[model samples]
Target: MTPWILLPRRVVSFRMPILRQAFALQALHELGRLAPDLARVRAQRSLEASLQSLREACLTTLGMELDTLTLFDARSVVRLFAHAEQARILAHLMDERARTLAEHGDYVGALSDTVYAGQLLACSRQRFGVQRDAGAAEALERELPKPGP
Candidate 1:
């Protein structure tokens, strides 16, 4: 009689073009969440290169465009790899923007952006199921140290 042996099989997961685009968007969003202030500060120049790289990677790998994937739609994806430090950075940046606007006498704009920032921070926390940390919204508010009169 001959002895039989079993071999393990490897499985591969395939990602579609749309899915790749979604992933890229999620990456960008997370980058924003990680360093919101840096993102805003270098919004035009810095991120462009990385954004272009993602675009090219998607196009070459999956043949798709990045714009079709919206940030809201990418929320769940972003949460999967959320980094607490980055999220905190983003919160701080948003708070800074709000403060700057207020100081410039643009109360309405300041309030609006501040609210938006808060919403983003909340979404990140809720989605990632992360406990509020030192860099969270509360910390951001206190540390912002808004300019005085």
Candidate 2:
């Protein structure tokens, strides 16, 4: 009698999980710059580890579970993968955060977050638009930062 072993087949994903996590991490780092206290707590953790960190920090930093965090915790959602629509959503959230910060006497923090939120808006526009005409492109070029010679 011959014994046979069967191998299971599974479809491979087009994108790698690590790449997804890297992108998420980059987004989180960028957004974290807006929420300094939150950023400081999450600085050392990787995106893969962040959900768990959030769970842990829930009690320690936030005084609630990660799942319990709400719009008041908008910064918590900044790590999500975003396209044009999500970028718009994040930009609005940041705008709201800036207002919140300004009301709380964090004027510098509000300004920094507002700038980052504007960057997010630019990201959204560039993602879904047609190529700019020469004049529009020139205007954008004048406004956008250019590398120093």
Candidate 3:
């Protein structure tokens, strides 16, 4: 007979932090879409707080513990799904952050954030077969500063 395996309490604790981070970031993204100039300072503060919580969760939980581990492993399938969803949430958040930064005249920061978001989307495609629009990333990439002579 097969045995029933249970997840560790520590791993279970990871869910709420992940859910909170996702919700917070999603709200920031929605706000940016609705009003770019308005509420940006609040959005920035919210993003920073959520990211701090996310950082702690990643350290304590299994989040990003094994970037070397591929998504094909059956044991990590649940984590893979959870992380994929987080990636989507984070990509949107970073995209909105980039827009907000650009609006504030922080071009370099905007480019950096935009690039990171693109990388996350690329990873999402590899892990979860979720291919977001590449055109958006490319459009932002074009606006990045060119190499100087």
lDDT value, candidate 3, whole model: 0.48
Across residues 1-149, which tens digit of lDDT does each residue of candidate 2 receive? 22322222121243455555445344434334334433333445443343354344333422334444333334333333343333443554455555556655679967976887776556445543533223323333343243334
lDDT of 3 by residue, 75-108 (tens): 3333354444455444555565576667667799
Best first by lDDT, ranked: 3, 1, 2
Alpha carbon lDDT at 105, candidate 3: 71
Error of 1 at 71 (Å): 8.5
lDDT of 1 by residue, 1-149 (tens): 12222222111123354454465345444433434333344344443453454344333322334333223433443354335433444434445556555655679967975776566566677764566443344444443334345
Sort by TM-score, best first. 3, 1, 2
Candidate 1 yields a Cα-based lDDT of 0.46
TM-score of 2: 0.35
Q: How much does each candidate deviate from the true structure in C-alpha RMSD?
A: 10.5, 15.7, 12.0
Q: lDDT scores for all predictions?
A: 0.46, 0.44, 0.48
Better of 1 and 2 by TM-score: 1
TM-score for each candidate, following the candidate numbering? 0.39, 0.35, 0.40
* Candidate 2 ranges with C-alpha deviation above 4 Å: 1-82, 130-149
Instruction: Give model 3's TM-score versus the native structure.
Output: 0.40
Best-performing candidate as measured by lDDT: 3
